[model samples]
Target: MKQKMIDVSIHLFDKKGFTETSIQEIVDELGVTKGTFYYYFTNKQELLTTIHLNFIEFLLKKQEEILQDEAKDSREKLRAMIYMVLQSINERKKSARIFFREMRNLGPKYLEQNVEKRDQFRKNLQQLVEEGIHKGEFQEDLHADMVTRGILGMTNWSYYWYNPEGDVSAEELTDIYVEILLNGINKSD
Candidate 1:
């Protein structure tokens, strides 16, 4: 029942902005009563917070697992991380939309918690870039932090415009992105 409400709410929140989505609408969509919602969640905000936490925590766990694999080089780890994110976007399209778009609607405490997790994710990527540079795989002249942010920006922005059913598959898009990141698009002299 709790997961049902969350799934329905993610669809609603994705289709309609969080501020615009009402408890009544969610309940109606789920064909459940207000008492049932209240039994599980204290209020709409609580539900939103739960959604935000679940989304980030799931991604974070996956990121940590990828980082822990010693057999893969830094480059492979980076590719796997980007692929994981793109795969998540494809699999949980609505939830990804809601996670990125409606995060600001969370209360102060929830917002802070989510932000911490997000920052940690970014830091892990930054560390990967640093490792690549240290190992002489990536250009030593590159700025690790800035490059990390750029990589994340390129992948995360896909949530807004990427169509899972489009001609370009997620794996293809990841290849393009990873190529651009590893090799500049500019023609060599």
Candidate 2:
């Protein structure tokens, strides 16, 4: 029952902007009464917050696992992280859209919390890039923060057109991204 409510919330929030989506619409999608929603969440905002928190936690856990793996070096960890982003879209495609698209609707405090988590994620990626440069895997001139933001720009944009069921899988796309990311566009002298 709780899962269904969250699912309905995701769909409704994605289709209708968070401001446009009402508690009544979410409950109606679940075919439940208002009381049920109140029982699980105090209001629509709380429900959206809950969903965002869950998604953030999920991403953080994956990131921790990827970073902890010593079998692979920094480059592989970077690939894993990119793969995680694309995989997330495949697994919870609509959730990614809702999580990003509806963020402005979050209360200031809630928005700050989400921003903190997002910052941590970005820092982790930057650290991984730095490690790669130190190891000579990536060019020494590379700026960790710049590379991190570039990767985020590329990966997040995948939501615009990437279909998990379409021609490519997340793993395959990650392989392609890895090549472009670690290698430069310039021709080797």
Best by lDDT: 1
Shift in Å, residue 132, candidate 1: 1.0
Model 2 per-residue lDDT tens digits across residues 1-189? 888998888888888878898888888888889999999987777788888888878998999999899999987899889999888866887888888788888888678888889889888888888888899988899777887999999898897889867788888889888888777577988
The Cα local distance difference test for each model comes to 0.89, 0.85
- CA RMSD per model (angstroms): 1.2, 1.6
Alpha-carbon deviation at 16 in model 1, angstroms: 1.7
**Predicted structure 1, TM vs. truth:** 0.95
Q: Which segments of model 2 are wrong by more than 4 Å?
A: none
Provide the clashing-pair count of each candidate structure. 0, 0
Every model's TM-score: 0.95, 0.92
Query: Across residues 62-122, which tens digit of lDDT does each residue of candidate 1 receive?
Result: 9999999999999899899999998987787787888888888897867898899989999
- Model 1 accuracy (lDDT, Cα): 0.89
